[model samples]
Target chain A: MNQAGYSEETMTNVRAEKVREVARLATRTGRARSGEFLAEGPQSVREAMALHLHNAGHGGQPVVRALYATEECLDRYPEFEEMAAKASGVRTRLVSAEVLSAMADTVTPQGIVATCLIPETSLEAVAGLNPRLVAVLCRVQDPGNAGTILRAAAAAGADAVVFTSGSVDIYNPKAVRSTVGSIFHLPVITNADFGHTITTLKAQGCTVLAADGYGAADLDVLQDDSAARRNENQDKAMLEEPRLESPTVWLFGNEGQGLEEAEMARADHRVAVPLYGKVESLNVGTAATVCLYASARAQRRNCT
Target chain B: MNQAGYSEETMTNVRAEKVREVARLATRTGRARSGEFLAEGPQSVREAMALHLHNAGHGGQPVVRALYATEECLDRYPEFEEMAAKASGVRTRLVSAEVLSAMADTVTPQGIVATCLIPETSLEAVAGLNPRLVAVLCRVQDPGNAGTILRAAAAAGADAVVFTSGSVDIYNPKAVRSTVGSIFHLPVITNADFGHTITTLKAQGCTVLAADGYGAADLDVLQDDSAARRNENQDKAMLEEPRLESPTVWLFGNEGQGLEEAEMARADHRVAVPLYGKVESLNVGTAATVCLYASARAQRRNCT
Candidate 1:
């Protein structure tokens, strides 16, 4: 057994017991206890290792905790040998297919898995944010929805994301998988008090926009203004744009029951994308993207 | 055995055999041979039934083939009971939890399952479509990716979708579930020839825009000309905005390899979304949504 108490031989073995335990990590309780979640496929594992290195204050080196592989994995990825060799600090374990399958969270293990801790970010780091744009998710239960929203927010240049009570865990393995590693690139806060978050943003002089299906404000009107601002000096123009000057918070609600009446009432503006289709509404993740991009377009138009 | 070698009594008696059969339906060959694919959850089942009704020209009433349910399902959904009461032609088979589990495609069966035939649409129905927008996916292997793209295409007012050769089977249970009934709303053609599709679209003068992450044509730039046109019309004495026109085909490619160089080279235009974040690229689904909406937004801007 190595210092971690997992026998080098046992850790490298594929057993039913290990597979069951690894699959159980899909549940919240199992992940919390183990301080680990499953990340599969080469892209996801690479992102995990990259995030570790990024957080370790290194530019391009790998800062992985543990790297596991099978003979098939090595055969499929000859390049990985050189890459792993460079990360000397990272512990390596060679396991069989049985072990790989047992430790895999996905139906197909792709012959590799890695263990890494979720990096903790302090509230103080995000509190001083002069965010021109932000994403706010309230009671969104599905981890996929929350993760996709975080990804969209980051892509749209939102400075931070705040998840009010009742939302899924940001670190949920499914959520992490959905974000495609954007989780490590942005400030994501969870289990925050809705009232407090709103108050803090309002105090910061930010505009709070609630995205409702029947929102009164038209999305086109915002997009038109933002496009105009982008043509001028961005730094000076940012302050002039109504959407940008007012640090904005976009609130997306639970999958089943959208934003609460009180929560919608608290926002300075309510906006919606026009729907002409048979379906009643867009999924929360899709809606967040449209809304965030609309705000981004609006901010750009007005700033210039 | 009474009709079709599957009598009510025989089905009731052979619970294990039925489950084995249902589980086998996960594969394309099984689904095709049985003339049915699995659909569960009250929402999806409802959608499936509605799809059946529309196909039968019953003016919005479903023409179900069979319904396997427990008392729990009937009790929880009185609407299901009421619908069952009205539909005498459809078969309803009361089942036990064990029976339903065998029939379920999901990890946790919603205590109900249904078997329905895949709907068919012809090329003539979509040819020369004016207000129609369609998503053409080529070789997208991931069921989730296919599903997400379908859902986004529907939201952006697509009239239909077509899956080219090498794409994941649209009837895959996970793909159907991910679509969230968009499958029912849109006409989908699968296993199509690319050369033939491109020829038909060209005959209709349907602009084909392929999405590539490295394309020189900025997606925002494509919108710029249209946005300029809108401003021109408003000025009266100014100019007319250039419109890409609606009913265009947006081609998205495989998840990992993305659009093939040859395929993209033949496109009318290649567009790429700007990325400022650490994440290398957006998920296939998210990327499709952005491109689809950009096109929709451009057309709407010009029309108005």
Candidate 2:
């Protein structure tokens, strides 16, 4: 190896304990400590570096502490060098494929992994958009389900996603990997007080609607013009004389408990996907996608 | 322990090996021999059992096998007991949690899993659907992606899904898990010749549309009747005759390579999803959902 090539002599400590520890960080608890999670593959690393540069300009701390790039990543993507060069505040360490294997989360690492800090956004900042549609996750435990919901929310044009109590860390490595970079685009807020959040949205003249497995609000009925007009009138009466349009928040509940009775009661409307199979309910992710898109489709049609 | 509790005793050769082997079957080779892949959760198990019953009757293997319901599963829902009793040739056995754990695929199994022989579906049988819309997967390897695509196809009303060379096993436990039981409702065919399949669809006057990142056909063209008509004359001239508007087989390729040039060239139309991110492509599942739904939406509007 060339002396100047990646400065192997100056490489940071790859202590046995540290390797064992980071491997353990594969779990959710370890990831929360550093306020950082792992992102693998060339595409993910590139996006993290770009986001790091963007956020670093703000008072936000540098998110990516390490960039593990393999020979193939360097050779195949010359842009990796460009990104690494621009990430001035972030540490960029070059590791061999063998070392890379230890740090990488996926079975196939795609020759790169970057440690990225979870980005935090405030509810007020999100509300500033006066977003017509939003998604709320309650006690969603599965990272894949949570990540898929986030991806669906973004694709369906939901203004933001808020995680209520007991949901998995939005920054879990599996969740991040599952999002396939959708995490970079959406406004995600976690650990919210569900009741207060609903109240606050109501104060802002937002209609808080929770998706219930069993509920009276027929989504199909919501599509009807007569029913929508009735909803609009009801919204106007609930708030004030001025009648500021009420934004809608679509709440999804935990996998097992689903929506709490209290939460369901708080919702202006409770709705479900009409299902036709021996299987009673769709998977949480699928349900969220179908619901979010249904809302989006409805809103788009109504607006036009 | 009761003698009748477990059909096979704990001391038998099958006990320890069964648990260890189920754990080891994470690899592909092991799954092939078991002839039975795991399906997790009450929902997955329910779907698998129904499919098993349906296929058993269809294939003339109508000998209903023993029904092994774990104690926990029975405790959770007593309703299963009544249903289990009514089914002919079904002998119910109660398995301990330990034995159930050995058979589970998840770290925290939903406390329910069922074993069923893979349902066999021939390509000719599915093609007989006169499938107005079919999803064709060529060399897609990820179990999650394959499963999600199948789920999406079912949701979007695709008549069937055909998997070609290099595709993951649709019957793999993880793949089945990912499908969310959509596998039971839809027709899925695996291990078909890619070239022959394409030609077969083409001969039937079915448009073989391939999804490509650099597709010439604008996706919006399908949404508007005028645009579709405008392109129809040009397309007809190239084909030497006007198409009578038959069914369509939409091809999705490997996650990494996408559709090959030769495959795309054979396509009656090539369509691409417009993306707005540094990441080049959507996850295969998301991409397939957007495309399939786009076509379905178009079809719905045209029908009305």
Task: Find the candidate with the highest DockQ and give its number.
Answer: 1
Candidate 1 local lDDT, A1-304, one digit each (tens): 2323122563544545555666666777877887666666676777776666555555543335666777677668765565566555666677777777777666676888776554454334565776678788999998877888888887777888888887898777778777876776777777788988888777777899898888877666566655644544446554332353356888888887899999999998888866645666777887888778666655544544
The number of clashing residue pairs in each candidate reads: 13, 0
**Tens digit per residue, CA lDDT, model 2, B1-304:** 4423234443222376645665445556766765545666777666655655665567644222444456667678665555554445454556556766666666656566555544566766676666677889988999888987888787667788899978998878778877877877777788888888887766665778787767766443343332233334434433321121336678898988888788787788777754423335656676676666656544543333
TM-score of 2: 0.79
What value does the lDDT take at residue B143 in candidate 2? 89
Off by over 4 Å in 1: A1-41, A48-64, A69-104, A107-113, A228-246, A300-304, B1-25, B51-63, B68-89, B92-98, B107-113, B234-243
Predicted chain A of model 2: TM-score relative to the true chain A?
Answer: 0.83
Q: What is the lDDT of residue B169 in candidate 1?
A: 94
> What TM-score do all the candidates reach, one by one?
0.82, 0.79
lDDT of 2 at B221: 35
The positional error of residue B289 in candidate 2, measured at the CA in angstroms, is 2.8
- Clashing pairs for model 2 are none
